[model samples]
Target: MRTTRSSTSRSACLPSLLLRGGLTAVGAAAVVGMAAAPALAAGSTTVGPAGDYFSASLSNSATLTVGSVTVTCSVSQSAPSQPLGTNSANQVPTANSNPAGPVTSTINAPTFTNCRTNMPLVNAQVTTSGTWGISAQHGSPSTVSFQIPQGGLEVQTSGLASCHAVTAPDGPASVAGDWTNGNPASTLVFAGDTVPVEVTGGFGCPTAATQGSFSATYQVRNVSTPSSPINITA
Candidate 1:
């Protein structure tokens, strides 16, 4: 009778142990699945290869305007020395979504040449203050929206004695445009986008205007691989 009772107890506990073991195995599998989930969702938006330098040249004459005063620049360019950075697609987002940014680099101040204003400042020179921010906010596989953050673009004018002006508080200005990846070179197009600025100057300045507009097109080329164009991909 003792042997039989021991055997019966062993049989009953065996099923319980197996049931608990099955539940533990299922839990472990769930954890493993969770761990592998992120690997499947790793799409991204990237700008060229990492650490690449690039230069942008104006494809068309650029313009800077405040109210009735318009400054047309025959040449404009940005040279980026900082290494390029990468970003995830979710971070940059699409044009339809609210996008953050993948600020690639702080570029050198853009140079504007042959700048002549609608006002009498024929010899006007456009000089920028502070480092400019290069960022990608939204896009598709071939195109992305670009930004130069506020304070990234501050233009101080110097030429004639009566033609000294500056964008107040460091321009409190920004640049917004679209980038389209292409062969030979990528293109950035700024179609007369306007931002707020307080223009202060001695005389013959557009102080009455509260906003400024920039319009230009640029072609971006990779410095390292001159044959390859810089690409912004999502």
Candidate 2:
């Protein structure tokens, strides 16, 4: 009779122990599942007026300063022959969404005019060579930042014997700026951007400097449809 009673007691406790163990295992599994959940997915980008040419004109005068020399350009893109700059394909209907810029376009060099140096009796001439490129970098709803590929813009400066400089012998300089979408035209602003340049002249040159800076604002418009503004959504 004593043995039977002990056996019955053990059997009654078995289900309770099993239930507790199973509940603990399930709780741990739930926690692991939550921790492994994935993040939100990104959407694709779209551009308006697809497959159209766009030009950029200076909304403000451009300034380039290297060491002791400061050059200001008053006229850019006044005529068709002296176009400020051009970019290929104002449209990318199906572009992958990435802040690191998976979209790219070919860009031409810009011409500067009415350029003069801060130093008296010294003139400034700026020349650019090679086909540059622009790529999307990062952006928000209203504006997007772009990265101009390096080594595409070769800025060679020649003028008075006292003031001459170049970007690099084998390599060229590049820049970064922001673009804002609008109706009539888009805007590009370069606020005190730093570019690499070296001085290789005799007197009054920024011989001791290894870098140069420039600032300008440009308004972009579609050539085919002057009223259509370039729009980039990411």
Candidate 3:
């Protein structure tokens, strides 16, 4: 059985994988182990700089099948309340703030089917963590992009024998959108391809095989004022 893995690129914002504090980048390397704790529940607000601080969640979901078993996967991320730093040129503070907190991704409700009697698939959950930032970009609407640098975050999963879930770990993963007046419910769609999960422990499939890939869309909203849109200032 032959499987392919996704490729990633370096991030300009975060050149170094490790930041000042202990927060790790997202697209680094996969650490085979049990899944980490579930990300903080959605709706939790993180107060930051003054421009546009909001909570964002990935809307698109993907399906990964192993042999006869299939599972639906989705991810969500929460920004931190503290400020990281300000861009000297633009004079605007970065999103989620300096010494940024860990932005976490949680897989919503995963289940499995079609497993052997003895090696039945147990609980399944995948979590990704990384620092986040907003960068200035040149375009029609004058937009800013959100980036989770390579090696800035870590991916892990729990439940399937030696199988562990891994997201984009080699390059930076980001999404951008045009400046919005103030629509908090606006959705920013992007692509997060190839979540290669390793299946070991003689669980019927070959060891270290690609479980499948996932594509996601994120919805950005202001938690403070649910009805109001988040204001983005470049």
Root-mean-square deviation of Cα positions for candidate 3 versus the true structure, in angstroms: 13.1
The reply for model 3, stretches above 4 Å from the true place, is 1-50, 59-71, 82-122, 136-146, 149-160, 168-182, 192-212, 224-228, 231-234
Model 3 Cα lDDT, one tens digit per residue, 146-171: 44344333222233433333333455
Per residue, candidate 2 scores C-alpha lDDT tens digits across 50-79 of 655566677667766443345566654311
Instruction: Give the runs in model 2 whose Cα sits over 4 Å from its true position.
Output: 1-44, 77-102, 141-160, 168-172
Q: Worst ten-residue run, lDDT, model 3?
A: 13-22
Candidate 2's displacement at residue 105, Å, is: 0.7
How far residue 120's Cα lies from its native spot in candidate 1, in Å, is 4.6
lDDT by residue for model 1 over 124-181, one digit each (tens)? 5455434444454334423222323243334444444233333323423343455677
> Candidate 1: misplaced stretches above 4 Å?
1-43, 81-103, 138-161, 168-172
TM-score of 1: 0.62
Ranking by TM-score: 2, 1, 3
**TM-scores for all candidates?**
0.62, 0.65, 0.44
Clashes of 3: 17
Ten contiguous residues with the weakest lDDT in model 1: 25-34
